[model samples]
Target: MAELRGTNPYHIKPPEPKVLPKNYTQGVDNLSSEDFLKIYIETLRYQDPFQPQDLSKMLEDMTRLNQIRYMNDMKSFMEGLKGWFNQITLLSSLSLIDKEFVFSTNKIDTLKGGQYYLLSSEDIKGATIRIMDGDDVIKEYQVDINKGLNPIELSDLPKGHYSVQILKNGMPVDSLNLGVMGKIKSVSVSGGELLFELENGELVSPSRLIYAGGM
Candidate 1:
């Protein structure tokens, strides 16, 4: 028999160590606090008994988790405060809509021999009032504001149907639809001069008129 020259089967090469891809632990940082806590507990349960986790490392991880939780709470509180302030500002602006004012006009109808007036309780200081008849520019005047009733004369205007406006510093101040009131309910022409019946039931000459309307 020929001597066996075959290589020894017991000389089998050890299996190559398994190689893992890089970035395998990249997603671990995205785990929620609860999930990370559960993973840590499981890792400790199965960790090799001889190589225990360090107490200092565990304390550091817990401290970092607490800091993250506090920061999240602070961010939530700031967001709520911002929402509350915006609501307050909106309510404050809405409060201005309820205020009323009284305004005056300077439009006079010269041919008709009468003047017009407007009455309102809304503030009209620093406003401009314009008077128009059909397509004609009768008169325009600025509102002179005072604490109480303000009087504006419109006797120099032309006679006809007239309209009045209330402005504040050249801008419309209030949207209240003001109505006109006569100095007296009825007027009687006397001495070649037109008279007016004011809403207060007082009879006065057109020249003595201040405002043309009432609120």
Candidate 2:
């Protein structure tokens, strides 16, 4: 170590860091197909006088660059398609307002009395219909099943949801749900998707609906 003449002699200078231009970007981060092609040309231009570049390796690199470029283009196209579909869906959902729809559910909205139907695939003479609220039996009624749409009317039930079970041969064979008629009240956006708000305090997706009647 060289001796210093100043009083403070233990200090050492840190090396200055290399600076890049403001527009300079790293090849590893922003490398594209054009940049890669330019690199290939430059490599060929500055090749060795004796030994030359391997043609196979250069072709492999070109192929990889082309594949990456194609994938990025496809990604952009798919993103555009998604945006168009969302726009169409938003426009269509707006027209669904104030329209009444019936979905397959166990919910039944009753005022004085409501009509419920049983769709039988075959003919049957006697089968019991049990209206249930969850595990508890609310009401037990009989339906004249005849392999068709059998309508059943019960006394004024509470304005809520109920499930109907079909009992044949003193045992429950099948179970179906009584649906409620609801009208769309308004629309709301949630997570970039549209939600249909019903008059009965329900939020559902327009895609989930299978049947819709007049406004």
Candidate 3:
């Protein structure tokens, strides 16, 4: 048999060693603490005898490096914690599905009709219930008010989202309190905020909900 002159295809070649310049320590953002220490040692070995490196500054740099590492580790831990919290929130909210909850809100989204209430401090005459679609008032109802919780009844308007405002004497009531009751259809998250989709089409935040109970 002829002597094997060609290189063997199955033979694996060793990777080349990485070489750094003498006393190299320029870019170190990606370097680990051990790698940085090795570079620091090399820097000290090749440092000029007439103009030695500043000991205090070197110590400060090492301290800063360790601090950066610590901060990075903390950031990773926080990210994991946030993920865990979101999962918990999602799991917890699933239990509220099909359960009735009384939440506070000023908006109504429904196909047929909607139910809401106004928490009035005092009875006032000639108050207007202004249903707003964007900036325009789509519907209005003139009615007298009563102290405590006053029920608001809305007819089946077109299927859409609308904002409800109580106006007294043509000015918006600044201290208006509006609330609604609906069964939870679904639960979701948006921008890290927990949200509940009501059976009547309202999207409410958990922070806004004041009461929860069965239908």
| Index of the highest-TM-score prediction | 3
lDDT of 3 by residue, 4-62 (tens): 77433334333333355676554354577898678778978999989988867876776
> Compared with the true structure, what per-residue lDDT tens digits does model 2 show for residues 1-215?
99877322223322333344687543333466798778878988999959888867866665677668657766776666555555556555676788777544555446423345555567766788777789998888776676545555657566666767888878876643344455789887676677888886778876656444432
> Candidate 3 lDDT (Cα, whole model)?
0.73
RMSD each, Å:
31.5, 20.1, 15.5
Q: How do all the candidates rank in terms of lDDT, highest first?
A: 3, 2, 1
Question: What TM-scores do the predictions have?
Answer: 0.29, 0.56, 0.57
Model 1 error, position 16 (Å): 99
Error of 2 at 15 (Å): 54
TM-score of 2: 0.56
Residue by residue across 66-85, what tens digits does model 1's lDDT show?
66865766666665555444
Using lDDT as the measure, name the better of candidate 1 and candidate 2.
Answer: 2
Instruction: Show where candidate 3 strays beyond 4 Å.
Output: 1-44, 108-112, 121-149, 156-172, 189-191, 200-203, 211-215
TM-score for candidate 3: 0.57
